[model samples]
Target: MACLSRHRHHHHHHHHHRAWLTSPDPDMLHHRPLSAHHRPLPHDDALPPLLRTPHPPRLRHGRHRPHPRPQFDGPDPIWDAVRQEAKREVVQFNSLCASVASIAFLVFHFNCVQAEKEPILSSFLYASILAHDCLEQALVFVLANRLQNPTLLATQLLDIFSNVVLHHKPIQRSIRLDVQAFKDRDPACLSYCSALLYMKGFHALQVYRIAHALWHQGRKVLALALQSRVSEVFGVDIHPAAKIGEGILLDHGTGVVIGETAIVGNRVSLLHGVTLGGTGKEIGDRHPKVGEGALIGASATILGNITIGEGAMIAAGSLVLKDVPPHSIAAGIPAKVICGLQEHDPSLTMKHDATKDFFTHVATNFRDEMPNG
Candidate 1:
């Protein structure tokens, strides 16, 4: 027993040390408000003659214009997942304790009597369950990387376990550094974060993570099969071929769909009854393409070959039939650009700003239309 505990401690520290030595600090990357639903900006979803790709901030005259990032520190999602996993860990620990105690007591009291029969299987089963959770945690990391190939922070999980009932003993030196470099997105997007947490509550959402890891490991069929099971259990369908990114939450998640060819970026969120489906009989590249930081609202239907750009918001009950630009809000039966995704004034989110922008655009065009008035 002592030997096993000692081995576990050594294994933990080794991982931490290696990750730090190899990977750069994740904090160095710009941290943004990584929720699916951030406030909209001033723009329309439909293409404007002047519109271009919404690139990150550029070097102004050889000086770096910082990426539009969050102003403060935020809660880490990986740590949050760890906190969640830890609750399971505690239950496992209790089971382990109980089984061990029961077995010990039986042996002490009925020494040769029970020793002559079959050994206890309950403890072994419970111990396997506990081991399953640990395996789940490790497998989740692989899935995240599969969904989005980028610099993923490994430390947020370290902090979560640190505060929980179990810590991966002594801790790995590199993982500690990974935690130290961990940059969690701002929690101001908690509504989205909360939704993702809710999705995790579903039966084996972590299965996708494992499948994702498997796909990367050259086991495509097995990966898709696992995803198929995840869809059956969770009612949330994500295509293994579809490229996804970091910090995304599939909230409420029932009937949430992703097409076989859909592309999703980091920190995006999709709510219940959301569809990323096709419009025609077209086969290859027929589905919609969604950009980074985009939000697809509840029961919204986005059909055909379209680009819903970065930071765009598709309001609830809307039918998106065309391309929607970055930083715009598309709502209504056949959704058009009602407003941009980044709306500054709180009073303007509800139909008011769209009206104001409409008049503002009209007033600016009045001179070209009518010389008087």
Candidate 2:
């Protein structure tokens, strides 16, 4: 009877070990043997492999492999290069202006000493140069010179204009490009210093940029005020709301008038007495959209929501009311398409001979003379 009891006990121990190995509950693997009521049912080897094995969260490749690191982090190289180039240009331009001012001071001082007179002009030059050490300071000085009134002192005006220029980086860049545009396009502009010091067009454009900034910031009263002063002083009446791109050449810019909603594209050349205006009492986007690299000759009047296409040329005194196609010449009153453009950008070439080209084409094509009556 004792032997039979021992055999029964061993049989029960073997059955429990088998049940633990083949259990469906993975928790059973980690825990100590459960109480009789809490024990899990035994599973068979015939159960599916997925049911038998628990899958932990995993990396995509495999458990042993590691993820790769990124090659770069931060600003892109192309943008970095562009920003660096702009900075270099600004520094070079400022240095050139300073050098020119120094030379002028020396020349004026020597002349005064030779003549045995008070160095009045030399003193003014020195003071001006001392007051304006950089382009932003110079621009503020110019604006203050014109815009200061009984209510506003030059210093007060300087502070306001300085804040607008210093706080906005794009305005500074635009100023640099504007200087470059003058040097590139205007044969009369001997250097960047000449443009900075003497070009009224450059002065007008920079002031307009400040006013435009004010307009965007909801200082409409101040913006309009600046606009009025600019028109009064420079004779260039560009509305504060007008959008003008970089590298614009407002050559001999006096009497130039850009309307409220006008949009002028990059590298455009507008000569004296040009009017980008509305027709009669019309309002709401009633101004021309002048495209990139276009040339508007002296006194050209482009009116009322018309698109002056890229690289198109408007002859002097032409009245443009319709959309001029890209790379074409529009001439005459109620301007007609005189001829297709041969040059890529007549503005850059500084050519105002569209009428000559038109006449030449007509002469060449119309071989038969007018029928002899």
Candidate 2, pairs of clashing residues? none
lDDT of 2 by residue, 130-169 (tens): 2222455555655665567766666566657877886676
User: In candidate 2, which residue ranges exceed 4 Å CA deviation?
Assistant: 1-121, 357-373
Question: Which whole-number lDDT from 0 to 100 does residue 261 have in model 2?
Answer: 94
The most accurate candidate by lDDT is: 2
Candidate 1: tens digits of C-alpha lDDT, residues 136-231: 233323233223212222232222222221222212222222222222222222322122223341223344444445566677886676567556
Clash totals in order: 19, 0
TM-scores, each model vs. reference = 0.48, 0.65
Superposed by TM-score, candidate 1 places the C-alpha of residue 364 at a distance from the truth, in angstroms, of 29
